[model samples]
Target: MTSHKRWGLFFFLAPVVLWLFVMIVLPHIDLLVMSFRFENDEGQMQWSLNNYLAFFEEPIYWLTFVRTAIYSILVTFLTFVIALPLAFYITKVVNPKYQGFLLVLLLLPFWVSELVRVYGWMILLRESGVINHFLLKAGILRQPIEMLYRDSTMILGLVYTSMLFMVVPIVSVLDSLDNSLIEAAYDLGANMWTILFKIIIPHASPGIMSGSIVVFMLTLGNYLTPNLMGGKNSLWFTEQIYNQFIASFNWNQGSAFGFLLLVLSSIVVWLGLKLTRQNLKKVVQ
Candidate 1:
């Protein structure tokens, strides 16, 4: 309302505005332009949708794109499932004095780079790694088991990397919930299942939704974990994009794939919100 407040707000928002434009807007605009055109033999750029059409026409692209989207969603749901109980135990069951300690434990893994964590898993699961060595020493197995490079392994890596993101949000929302509500529900002859489904889940839905959105996007865009943990057999959409950009040097097709991925991921998030009967604004808040 006043010039002083306006100036203050402007100063506060300036960095974010600049970053969004410079980092997101400009790059995307260029990508969108590149997506629609490519230089032909005559050395002229012509607009076309064949880049997008190729995604459907080619089996590899079609399958990989769908697989990546499905896997990302599945990973998001799995993370939520694991996070719910973990968050509940941390926020509702743990003593307030030890809450920070538990959170610190959760955060400890994240302090190092994600690449490091994946490699840690790789080491633990490799044929001659710690787990196999332990198993062999204890006579639990006849021979070393190869544990790295599989869909389940890749999914495990994704879930491990994403757990904190989901748990933190859920814990944030759950901490605000009053224990008295659960007590009252019990007094009114409500069971644990009823109380959880009727009260706790509804109260925590916004946080769950917010966390899901972040995890989904992160998992969808993630390159390293899937590539390394899932091996060369993992046909992730990002790998396809990387091949187009780096391997084949086809920026136009890469841009098209990138744009399509953005659009589809957005749609999936929108549909999720609609199905859950949650508002994006409320979730964000």
Candidate 2:
């Protein structure tokens, strides 16, 4: 390559390389080092496996970790369930002119900050909030129901927040699908279910996998949604990490929790890829 081209390439790549090193690599290295050290009863910092061991030894910590994993999976599944049909409808049934408008509506909520969105849910679901007030006025219920700070409410918040992430990918894949394939399948005596399962799903697998991975990761790492919506009963692993770092001021334990979350999320993504028989390269594409 000519020197000018090489210089152009270097200029283009330099910012990304610097960003990866500065923002991601350095922080992870610092956290990894911190995870192995702890202040003892004597107030002296020492390197040990105690931070990790404590995770295994403490039932609450391990249980919360497992619970967070399960909840994240559930949220991803729920988001997929909600998004798939909506995506299909938007891409397949809706008029082409109106599709963009519908997608804009889906994205409108996200224009606001996530903290604001979660607070919006709090307002709608709280006993004295809109829903309850409406229901009481209509005599649907004599008393206001306790809605906030529940597991279902927390899951609902997660599903709502992550919906667009799941929908956009499915819509992209579905939009590219040729209508002739469905026509051919029908001509070959394939029913709706067969066409959906044998043709549509297979074509959409990459998008589904991509969307699932993104939504799952986001849901798993989310702190504000669970903490604010589920309150003290959330039992989310991220909450534990927050408590360690901010509340208790235990940086070592927080770093360990953070690493553990990273590991758990990796394993879950790996398992998802294996189960779906998806190529990571294709899914990411």
Candidate 3:
């Protein structure tokens, strides 16, 4: 390239390069440094694998990691299930004029902080909350059902929190689907379910993968939802990181845990790309 072209490219890329260094590279370097340090009785740092050793030796830490993985998987699947159907309906069946409004309504929760949303769920799920109150008033239960602070509620919160990410991609992809494809399927006597599974889904694979990856990664790093809804008894990996860094003052273990999560998310992104195996330009068009 010419000198002018090279300078132009550098000018355009400078901000992103600086951002990556400042936000990502710097912290990761710090984590690497901290992960090698060992704290003495005087609260000073030395060098050792004691932090990593403690992490591996504890079964609870491993269990927390597995629990986080399972929760992320479940939330990803649930988000896909809910978002796919809704996206299809909005793109195919809903009026074009109302689609924008409906989508905004679906994503309105973004206006509120996640902490507030979790607390809202808490109110709805609590024994004395609206859900139990309505059930009791209707005589559906003799007593209030225990709805709060469970795996199910945690999963629900995860799904709700990540729903918009799933919906937007699917909607964008489905909106671009050619109507003639479905018409051709129908003229050939393909049933609704057959058309959906065999034709529509294959065409939307890229969007599905994108949405799934986003939801899964977000859920994997999620701390507040699991903490608030799953409560203290629930084993979450991020909580373990928090305990190590804050309570135990073991920055090395926390860094190790964060690195583990980063690896898991990378694997998920790789698998998603492999499964989709479509060019970005084609999907965007």
Candidate 4:
């Protein structure tokens, strides 16, 4: 390219490039620098591994990390299972008018903030909530059953929030598929189960993989749902990090934990790409 063309390209990209460097790269650099520093006897900052040492020595951090990982995995799996069928039903089976309607419904929750959704769940799961009231009226139970603020409620909230990510991608992919291929499979004595497992799913594997990665990452970073739905017993990894940074004002240790989560998420995303052997360029394009 000519000098003028190069200058023009640079001008077009300058704002976004600068914003990324300032917002992302600078903060990460500051975090890395802070992670190595600790308070001295005089209350001045000094370089050491004390923050990391404390992290490794403490069981709470590791336990919360494991719990977060498990919760994210479960949420991802649940989102996939529910989203796949819904996407398939919408794209392959449902009428076009109704498909659009259902899509609106699927996206309706997004109109409300996630915090609002968590509170909505809180109402339903509480002792005097609609669910328990109905159950009692129907004689299903003698009294209200406790369902909120537990691991199960956290899983439910995670799955509900993350499911839209899974649905949109799978529907996009499935909508592009040739319906005749499925019809042909059925015509050739293939059952619904066989056709789905052997053909339809394989064809949409790229989207499924993409959706899984997105949902896992989102759920892994989630704090509000576990805190609101899980109550005092939640003790999620993100909550721990929040407490360190915001509540206790331990910036160095919080940065270390934040960096740790970043590393772990990167590794998982790498493995996901490896397992699928996906050309991310195709997905992006």
TM-score of each: 0.96, 0.97, 0.92, 0.94
lDDT of each: 0.94, 0.96, 0.88, 0.89
On residues 124-240, what C-alpha lDDT tens digit does candidate 1 reach at each position?
A: 998889999999999999999888878888999999999999999999999999999989999999999999999899999999999999999999999999998898988889999
Best by lDDT: 2
Candidate 1, superposed: residue stretches over 4 Å from native: none
lDDT of 4 at 52: 85
- Which ten residues in a row are the worst by lDDT in model 1? 38-47
Q: What would the per-residue lDDT of candidate 2 be over residues 142-186, giving only the tens digit for each residue?
A: 999989999999999999999999999999999999989999999
Candidate 1 has what TM-score?
0.96
CA lDDT of 43 in candidate 4?
98
Which pairs of residues collide in model 2? Answer: none
Whole-model alpha-carbon lDDT for candidate 1: 0.94
TM-score of 3: 0.92
Residues 17-69 of candidate 4 have per-residue lDDT tens digits of 99999999999999999999999889999999998888789998888888788
lDDT rank, highest first? 2, 1, 4, 3
Arranged by TM-score with the best first, the candidates are 2, 1, 4, 3
